[model samples]
Target chain A: MDKQYSEDSRQFVPETMSNMRFAVLVLGHGEMGRSMEHLLSGRHALTFWERNLEDGSENIPLEQAAAQKDFVIFALPALPHAELAERIQAHISDHCICLSIAKGMDEQGRTPAAVLGGVLGPAGRFGMIYGPMIAEEVRAGHPGFAELGTTQSDVYERTRELFAGAPLYLRHNTDVIGVSWAVILKNVYVPLLGAAEEAGLGDNARGFLATAALEEMARIIESRGGRRETAYSLAGLGDLVTTATSTGSHHRQVGRDLVHCAPGDTCGTGMNVHSEGIHSLNMVQRFGLLDLESFPLLRLVRDIVNEPRDVAAKFRPFLDASFADAASRNTRD
Target chain B: MDKQYSEDSRQFVPETMSNMRFAVLVLGHGEMGRSMEHLLSGRHALTFWERNLEDGSENIPLEQAAAQKDFVIFALPALPHAELAERIQAHISDHCICLSIAKGMDEQGRTPAAVLGGVLGPAGRFGMIYGPMIAEEVRAGHPGFAELGTTQSDVYERTRELFAGAPLYLRHNTDVIGVSWAVILKNVYVPLLGAAEEAGLGDNARGFLATAALEEMARIIESRGGRRETAYSLAGLGDLVTTATSTGSHHRQVGRDLVHCAPGDTCGTGMNVHSEGIHSLNMVQRFGLLDLESFPLLRLVRDIVNEPRDVAAKFRPFLDASFADAASRNTRD
Candidate 1:
C-alpha cells in the first residue's frame, strides 16, 4: 500500500518502477477508446484509429500502428472484432499483447476472445479486460478494477506495468474463456433489472434478480467450458451490478423503454443503437448456445423482450415459479 | 410453476394445500409486522402485540399471545430480542416456531440467533428470516425473497406453508448461524457503499466495493463458524445489494450523511435513527471478534465512520491499497 498519496490523489506514481512506458494503439476512438486515452496518454505513447474519422484527428493506417505498438487495445464493440483482428494479425509484433474491452458477442455469436484466438491462432498474445471498468468512470479519474485474462504471465506483467500508477487496476486470471463469457453474458441481465425497477418491484426484487442472475451466469459459463467461480467474480457479478444499477446504463434504458412502449413498438427510440443486451439475448437464443428452459430468469427476460407488453405481468409469475422451484430443489437436496 | 394465476393475481391460492391455516402472533406492530399481516392475514388467524398500545388496537398480554399462537414472529430489532425471548419462552407452546427478522447486534454484541439460542436453550424452535424482504416491497404486493434458516425440516415446511402463494418467498437452509451473521454483517457494508456514492465515486467504484465487501463478509462469516458459501447466498450478497442500492435505505443515508457533515458531526440527522450498520461495526470491533488487520475494506469503513472528514480523501487511498494488495497477491499466486 502506498502511504504518501491521499484519497484525492488522482494519480499515484508507482514507486517501484521509474519511467516505464509502452507504445500503445487504441482501436476505435469511441467512448471507451477516449477513456483509455485519458488514462494512458500521460504515461504511454498512444496512437488512435477509427473507421470513420472525426475532424482534426489523425487517421493512422492499421498495419503501421499495429507493427510498432507494444499493446493493441480493441476498444471497439464486438461487431467489428473479427474483421479488425484479422487485419492486424500479420503486422503486430510477436511480443505485443492484444487486449480487448468489448463486452458483447459478434454477429456470429462469438466472444472477442474467440475472435482473437481464432484469427491469431495458437500462440497469439491476446487477452481480455473485463469487470467494473465503466468508461465514463475511468475518464472521470475514479479508479476502475478489472480482471486480465491471459495465458502468459509475461503478458499479465506487462499489462500491469502499463497501467501501474493509473486509476485502472488489473488482477491476472488465466481463465480467459471464463472471464470472456462472464462479461459478455452479463449484459443480458441488465435490462431485466431495469424492467424490475420500472415496474416498481422495489429493492428486494433487484437483490433477488441480481443473485439469481449470477447463479444462472455461473451455470452458463460452466456449460461453455468456463469455470463457475469466474461468474461470481468481478467480471460477472461485479460488472452486472454496475451496469444493472447505474442510472446512465443504456441497457437499463432499453428495459425502462420496454415498459412504456407499445407491444410491437421498437424499443430504444432515438438512441439509434441496438442494445448489446437485446442483441446478445437474440444471438444466444438463435444459436441455441444453452438450454434457456433450465434458467427461469433468463427465459423470463427473453419472453419479455420477445413480446414487450405487460412486462410486470410477465415478471411476477417468473419470480413465484423460480422461488417455488428453488424451494423444491432445496428440499430434494 | 403455477400457470392458472395471472401476474395481477396478488393472492395465488396454493393448489397443493387445501385451506391449511396457522395462528400467527406478530410481536411489534411496526413496519415489518404490518407487512407480515399484509402477506399472511387472509390465510391465517392473526394477532398483533406492540410494546405500547396504539390508538384502537387491543393489547394482548405477551404470555397470552405466546401460549396460543402456532407461530411467533419477533418483528422487533435485536435490542429487545433477548429479553422478549426469555419472557415468552416458558409460556410459548411446544410446537410454536419463533422467527426473527432482526439484522443487528443487541447491547451485548450478540446476534439475535445467539440471544434466542441462549435464552430458549437447544430445544427452542427458533429460526431467522433474512434476505431481500424489504418491508415496503412486501406491503406493495411485490415478490420478496428470503432464506429461512432453521434446524428442523418441519419448521421450514410450516413456514413455507405460511407464506405459500403469497408474494413473500422462502428457501430453507439449516445454517442458522451462517444466515444470521451474513444478514447482520451486511448492514455494515451498506454505509461504505453510501460513502462511495456520496463521494461521487462512479458505478465502477460501487461494483468494486460490493465485491470486496462480499469477499470480506465471507471471510468474517467463516471465522465466526459459518460456511463461506452462505455469505454468497441470498442472505448476504442479495440483501446487501438491496439495502445498499435502495433509495429508501436508512443505512445508505448514513453513508451519504457522513459525506456532508463535519468531522465528528452527528450523522443521519432528521431521520432520528442510528444506522444498524454503525452499531454492528461498533459491536464487532469492540468485541474483537475478528482480526481487523486481515480485512482492509472493513477497516477502511470503520476508520471513515470514526473520522468523517475528507471522506473522499480517505476512500480513494483505501481503494488503491486494496486493489494493489489484490494485484500483488494475484501475482504471487
Candidate 2:
C-alpha cells in the first residue's frame, strides 16, 4: 500500500470504537460558533472566547484560549481574522490546529484560512471546514457533509479523529486554496439566483444559474492556481444550491429586495443586510485576478447591485450573452 | 476554423436576428407534448398525434404527421416509444430529424432515445432535449434551458436555429448517449430525495443527498459508456433538482406516500402512481449492468421502497459506510 493511503485509512476507524478526545477552543459566540459548540459537546473539553459576555460574566481571553487548546476554531467573521491571528500568534502552541468556518473574503481577496496563516506565520497549522452546513440544522443534529482542507496530512488525521462521531462528516483534502476559492465564490454567485426568483424566472432559472455559475467558478479557481474540480464538490455546488434556493438566505433576500424596491428608494429592507457576496465581488474587481470577460453571471450581479433598476430588462441581454458563451464552449472539442 | 464548429457557430445566431421555422410533428399529446405544442406556437407549422382526443375530434393519424414534418418529436413515455417508432418508421420523411423528450427507461433498461433508435433502424437521425423544463412552466411561458444532443453537428445547428427566439433556449452538443443516460438516470435518482423529505430529514439532508447522489450518478454514467461530466450539466443536475424538489412531481409523491403509509399496507396512495424511477430501478436490478456495491445510496433507496419502515434507522448505516468509503478515497491521493 502507498504511504499516504495507509495513513488515511488509519483515520477511517468506526466512531463507536474510537475514544480520541481533544481540548478545543472556539473563537466566536456567533451562530456557527454555537453550532460547533453543540456538535462538540460531549466529545471534547470546550472553551470559548467571546468579546463580551451576555450573562454579565467575564469571558476567557482570546490569547488564553489560543494557548491551551489542541484545536482552535475561528468562527468569527473573515474581516477580523488577520488581526485576531496576529494578537494570538505569540501565545498559540506549536501543535495547535486552526480551523476556520468563515466562508468569506478579506479586503485583499484572501480567504479566512489565508488571513489566519498570514498572521500566524509559517509555523502555524490551519484547515478550513466548508459545505452545505446551516447553523440551525447542525445545532438540531441534522446530517450534513463538509470538506476539511489542510496542507499538512497529520492535521487532517487529527481533525478527523476529533470529529470521529460528529454529525458533520468531514472529508479530508490538501487543497486548502481550492476549497477557499470555491466556498467564497459560491457566496458571490448565489445572489443572482435570488434575482432570478424576484424576476419571476421560475425553477428553470435556478437550473441555468447553477450550471453556468459553477462552470465559471471552476474556470476562475483554475486561473487562480486552484484545482477546478474543487468547485464541483460539496464546498461549491452543494452550498450554492443550499444558499441560492433557501428562502431564508439573507444574501438571496438582497437580490429580491433590490428588484422589488421602487426605483427612488435608496434604503430598502435588504440594503443594510451583510452580504459577503457583494464584498467578494468588490475584492474581485480590485484584484483583477480573473478575467471578468469569462463570467457574465457574476458581472450581471455586480451591475444590478450597483444600480437596482429594471432587473428583468438588464438581465435579458445578460442571458443572450451567456447563451452565446455556452454555445461557444459546447461546440469546442 | 473547424468545419463542425463553423456550422455550430453559424447556428449560434442571436435570437433577435434569426427567423427560421419548420413544420413540427409532436407525437403523444400528454402534458409535456402539450407544453411543446404551446412553446412552438406561432413559430412553426404544427401537427399533434394522440391515441384519442378528449373532444372526440378526428386527430391527424401518426403516420401522416410523421411524413409531413421536418422535425418529428416523440414526447411519449419510454415504454411506448419502440412501438410508435416502428409504426412511423416507413412513413417518416427521409429529411426529417427526430427528438425525444421522454426521460424514462423501458423494461429492458433502454432509454427513450435508445428505444426510438432501436425501432427506427440505422438510417434514422435523432437527438434528445433534456433539462429543468417542467411542462406547466413551459405552458406558462417561463424560460428554460435544454440541450440538443446529437452526433450530427448539422442537426444540432438546425434545431438551435428553429428554437432561436423561443422560450426554450437550446444549447448544442454531440453527446447523445451521455445526455440520454443522464436524463434517464436522474429520474431514477430523484425519488430518494422525496423519500428523504418525507422522512422529516431537514433541508441539509437534501444538500447531502444532492452532492452524494450526483457523485454516484457521474460514476454510473461513466461506467455505462457515457461521459461523467454529463451528470454535471443541465440534463442531469438541473433536471434532477427540478424533479426532486418540485411540489408537483409524481415520482417524489411516490416516495412521500411510501414512507407515510402505515405498516402492512401493500396499496398506499402512491402504489397506483406511475413512477419512471421505480421502473428504472427494477430494470437496473434485472440487468445488473453497473456494480451495486459502488452505489450505497441507490441501494438504500431500493431497499426502503421494498420495505418502507424506519427510514432514519436504515439510513444511518448507509451514511457510515459512505463516510468510510470517502475516507479511503481521500487517503489514496
Q: Which candidate is the best by lDDT?
A: 1
lDDT of 2 at B49: 82
Residue-pair clashes per prediction, in order, are 0, 0
Candidate 1 on B135-249: residue-level lDDT in tens? Answer: 8766656667788888877888888877776777688878888999898778888888998899876788788788888888888888888887788788998999998898888
Lowest-sum lDDT 10-residue window in model 2 chain B: B4-13
Q: In terms of docking quality, how is candidate 2 classified?
A: acceptable
B1-333 per-residue lDDT for model 2 (tens digits): 245323332332245335777999888788988988866767788888877646755376778778877898887888778877888788878878888888878768788877767776676788899998888766656677887777776777777776765677777766677888788778767777888777755566677777888888888888878788888888988887777766777767777877775688763324524777777777788898667777887798778777878765566677678777667776776
DockQ of 2: 0.34
Best-fitting candidate, scored by TM-score: 1
Instruction: List each candidate's DockQ score.
Output: 0.49, 0.34
Quote the B-chain TM-score, candidate 1: 0.91
Q: By TM-score, how accurate is candidate 1?
A: 0.92
What's the iRMSD of model 1? 2.7
Per residue, candidate 2 scores C-alpha lDDT tens digits across A1-333 of 245422322332234334778999888888978988867778899888877646744377778777877988888878778877887888878898888989888778778978877887776788899988877666655666788888777787788887776766778766778889888888888777788778767677678778888888888888888898888788888788777766577777877877776776763324534788777887788998667787777888777887778776666777677767667776674
